[model samples]
Target: MSTLGWWRLIYAAFAGFLLFHGFSASENAPNYSFMHNATSAPFLSYYDYIVVGGGTAGCPLAATLSHLANVLLLERGGSPYGDPNITKLVNFGASLSDLSPWSPSQRFISTDGVINSRARVLGGGSCLNAGFYTRASPEYIRQAGWDGRLVNQSYEWVEKLVAFEPHLGHWQSAVRNGLLEVGVVPFNGFTFDHINGTKVGGTIFDEQGNRHTAADLLEYANPRGLTVLLYATVQKILFRFRGRRSRPEAYGVIFRDGSGIEHRAYLKYGFKNEIIISAGALGSPQLLMLSGVGPVAHLKAHNIPVVLDQPLVGQGMCDNPMNAVFVPSPIPVEVSLIEVVGITHFGSYIEAASGETFSASVTTTSRNYGMFSPKIGQLSTVPPKQRTPEAIARAVEYLDNLDQAALQGGFILEKIMGPISTGHLELQTRNPDDNPSVTFNYFQHPLDLQRCVQGIQTIGKIVESESFSKFRYDYMSWPGLVNMTEHSPINLLPRHYNSSIPLETFCRDTVMTIWHYHGGCQVSRVVDPDYKVLGVEALRVIDGSTFNYSPGTNPQATVMMLGRYMGVKILRERLGN
Candidate 1:
């Protein structure tokens, strides 16, 4: 058991760090440049561009913008504490299933009432994401509703940072190869999982070295101008309330250092400059709401001042409900089970030379011929408006095929259901530190529920086929759709059998998250197309929160692109010279 003193130590250490490294606006302050002349009207900390939430989007934008402007990055978590929990990327088998040990330092889990994830430590999610690399497809990029400018810019930008190298490690089995050869992994005709650009299995991400994080990418991009201030959390966006007639312009940001000392960091002073918010979908909207920037009704209920009347600030949020199938491989087990599980996880990356992360996933490739493929004929392509009976029927058939294959792949999983998008981030209290009321709201969306069923069905289909006939496995899933729990129920005394559950609900119950949360400060639909919070000036959101909806895959890469694009927009507007 962890002691209360331990928590005190962690808390104290964080506080001390802020007093020393954060702004003081005094001669004794730690703003290296201001030590000689600290008494200034501008205060202890100021910047041309101040980025909050130094995670995936924040770090990159801060780093990029620093090249042309002064950047100050504020994070809520302590820096370089060297906690292995937040440093190493491990999400295979048991690691992925269990959360207690991995995300122990996490302060926030559900971003809003929507996501069910935790990565508040120094490196944030980038420290632990299975560095699956996904280069934006031109088609998918365009589909994001951005003009060609953003997509082309992102591709050009990513290509500069994404330095992919082939992982020459020997494969334990030909599962990935066999799947790729069979057109299951390929989208167009090639695979995108390989960092080395080949049809290989288990692209080793770490490359037997230190892990690469989003912080790494930012630092790598502009090592000179970047100053990462960890343990500093942005409390509010400073606004000069200019009454009802004119738009309230953003002055800068108010943040709390680790020790809980408050300070302000200004964006380059001008009435025209903007305050870019890239603090993930959850954080961005939550901050917006706290600052009286969401639905007037909701803000009033929380006693939060309504800075803006954006009703959709937190609405229209969605994330991909990821389902994982852990396969038990017996093909000459070279590494120990612990080692094997530690490796081979999803999207694991090792930083080589700045491009994408380390070992990446074979994602969005020409080889992936499944639903992610660009092909329309093979999918239930009906738009959100049309959920025709025929479409539902076809989806059910597809579901049957997807679930079986997942099981046959030698999955080392026990729980295969219960993940619902019903989870949402609601204000638990007036306190910012208080955990939000979370509801998965899983099986909430008819179409999303259908997709979950299809994923399970497709995996099952693969298991039933001759592709996995030799690997005999039990039909162990939820009660109605598959089989009964062979062993004891997970942490139970007297478990009841859910035998009569309907197939649809059973399939719904079988759905779980892939842990990809996105779409909070939604774009075009939620915020303005330029990502500005409607009715607010000098304030824009550019992060996973800006996603229109969960893009059906890992959102980090996309969010990074958004941060870059938004930074570029901010740069071009004021400092375009």
Candidate 2:
């Protein structure tokens, strides 16, 4: 046989081996059986530690704790390993827009009328979000009072598994240059540390477009000591009080499985045996309130038994408001997630992604669509009398054109990193299955509006720069339905940028969440510096909800870092590690 023929035969065998191994690995994920489907199984009597909401923080924290103690990690959603919609980078939007009850993302519309979703999967937001990865700013670490050395070490632990250096495509490269041109200065190159500059950073998506989430951290778990139950919705924390003046202690969790059969899992008898609530910002507070740990009046109104009247349990919720400019490229650009970021001095951040088309479902929620028609009354110029049938028909036609343009997709995102405005979360119903009422209260503060305006202006500058000229795009306006080919940055601004009302209107109409919600269970107010609930014993809220303030970047890295740090701290305190 010829050498070439022999090489082909070898290649074929190698491909076959890979195909078989890939199928087997997924079918029997090394620790797959360790993950119990709560519907079919009998609950264990107890564990040394029970971590609620097996998400970004919970997965790692549970894994680490299992190194020394028997740990139970309960998740409301299924594993993300086998889902193509989650593993593929291009399907990032599809994962978030999926409204199915079993979908990893639970979609909700805020009181302010912005559509958003929170992660319902074991990996949590890491499974649903854009794959950008950056370490928390040093200032954030200092403010959180985290051990700096431990925090740095934790970054390494997460990065070893989920982090990757993105292979920037043409459009992403252009974006980097454009950010530099706009004075987001000092090219810091590839580094995970959050620095103020135009620089390439880590990503959760690899060169092959596969995503690695925090769930992968389970590889570090001592499988013998860890039990992960999926499709188990924690209804409330089971609390006990020893004396009249003693603080309520969380001893067990009441959760309903996929079969809707309720079960209880308790902690072993010891002071170190704890229940950690690693549910994200929304879920943590909702769980706390349901468990009767919120404001006294609010709990009483719902007829819930008050365990602790911690007023701050559901307060201080904040999310980064995002705005974007969709530039339709004349040429095809390689698909990419966030590669280069522009850390601006104005308390905002700029990041860009290149892909074939924007998610169709996302376009359906934009202002161009009729989803926001009810809120049109809030607009200053759109009078009530203007709600004519003819006007509606014209608006629909304009939206159709805008959707078509969006499908052509060159996407860039401008996010307000730090906003002063805060919101809150509250239970709409006592049921664990029901989503809580989330109010971002975006643009409620004067500074938030100004910051969003600055972000928009920065986006305009980047797109107008020489770096983006190769794309050759047209501007699409909201109300006026104006399309300009000359690319006038002035046209992008509102008619009255200096005026508070007009700017606020523009912001309200355009602003949407980047889904970096944090701070419901705040550090000093809800949970202490050690991450334990302020008024409770043996219970800690260890997710983004415990963030003292929003970090100045995508928060997955920070959440994972904190998870490891907390895990290590617990180990040292309890096991003398």
Candidate 3:
């Protein structure tokens, strides 16, 4: 209350602001930011490590390795800015192939024309993916020929550094609890094991509700040693025979960027010792063979010089195959961990990594019985066509009618959970400068069909459960707008229809890819137990492509751990025996 007190307080506030500015400025004499192209990007003929494919695996690998070595990370895409479609993590994650700009670009086209575009930009696939850390099932890991050791369970160590925290607001919190009241469970499988279950809750987000990507971790790295070259496409691998009649030695990397300008990422930039390729499954093999290190016949087809007669540069690929089943509900209007607790408990994940809206979810799923989904061919058979538009209209109207009846009977449709699943990743080319040709081959396996059938049946049973006896299903798409395209209530089940509403006899429709594309470069099929390319020297892959079998779940988290593990291996390799 004294005049002297007011004067003292004002002086203290002024002093505090000045002190803050002084400390911030002193940390860096002239702060150089990569976001601003700080100094025209340092390029040279030599660098300690030339990491090709500044992708999900490559970026983190480069950042971590740069802690002790000078590293050059080369990416094929342009800068991370100006692309509102890609930079906005939320929309970017949910963005379907149709809406994605990269989908139709020449960079993503395959010679065989089945569209599959997983990011070709600076941040790599993370830029286009939802941020779930889904790992493999035990069955998946064993099939991939990996010891359980490959799955990292040290969340404290990893999260402490990266802080994989969730960004749950009040609305999201309500959804989480409500999902538990329903039967949906968390997925705690062989991986995504949150050290103490903190990771099990829901969509993983940064403190600001933004998705945290591998690129976001660069701040944790010692920036002085890392050089990220965006818009640079690797053209070839510089290598030679180490001894008379011996395998070739990998020396460095050569790349041609967007402008057709050529540059070399030498191993001498930091300490000039080794190289690593984190270019994912497709890109990695393409680069390897382009530099003369793949199947001889394939290389010749691509008109590339055969450096090594390696037969398996791009074979034995695997990825998680999935089909998202939608259920309509208004009460539970957002994503929920309790709804997916079974998978969460198993580290099977649900991620906000996509940072999209509630309706735009990128979650992985599987049955509790440890079974895969049905093969594509064995799914629903073609039914006779509905006789007329009126008949078709009636059929869809009945689905609406049944939905209402179910609501009156106190239940919801639950989820689609079709019982079948299978994923195969196959390569289509050997061009190092281009993205690899790969396929999901989902629903191609027999058991996949059975799984889908079981899922649908389970959903029917849940909707009919006594737990939902109070609310009206209005089957008119209870949770979400399920009636978006009705025509359900097929008489295949044993449920009684109070109203003798006739089901539409004909309904065969095509569905677009839910964008859960995964598994192209298989683990054992592509490399040996140590993840070596079966025959290449000084090269290894540590990305999603390294997966051995598809768990039909989200594969991003597993891919990240693989990258982290590879970085450790590559770093150890550089240290020498």
Which runs of model 1 end up more than 4 angstroms from their true locations? 1-43, 89-115, 147-174, 177-204, 220-224, 325-424, 465-484, 488-503
| lDDT (Cα) of model 1 | 0.46
Q: Across residues 333-424, which tens digit of lDDT does each residue of candidate 2 receive?
A: 76676788998888778887665433333313443211122222111123223434454445445444543433343556677876678888
**Candidate 1 C-alpha lDDT tens digits along 225-296:** 555665555777877767758887777877655345666777666544556776665677778777777778
Candidate order by decreasing lDDT = 2, 1, 3
**Candidate 3 lDDT over residue span 1-577, tens digit each:** 3463354334334433443344231222222143221123444466677778766666666767877777677776544333333333333323322222223112242222223355666556665554545444566556655446634442222344333545443333333333333344532322354321222432234443344455654555567887776556677888767688776667777775433456766655233266777776567766776787767777787777777787756655433322222333334332222212223232222221101122222321211000001110111111212223344345434433443323211111111122134333223554344456654443345454334334334434444444433222445334433433344422222233233421111111111132344333345656666666555566666665555443434545555555566666667666774
Q: Which is better, 1 or 2, measured by TM-score?
A: 2
What are the C-alpha RMSDs, in order, of all predicted structures? 12.1, 9.6, 12.9
Report the number of the highest-lDDT candidate.
2
For candidate 2, the clash count comes to: 0
User: Which runs of model 2 end up more than 4 angstroms from their true locations?
Assistant: 1-31, 357-406, 474-504
Candidate 3 positional error at 50, Å:
1.1
Error of 1 at 13 (Å): 2.5
Q: Using TM-score as the measure, which candidate wins?
A: 2
Worst 10 residues of 2 by lDDT: 369-378
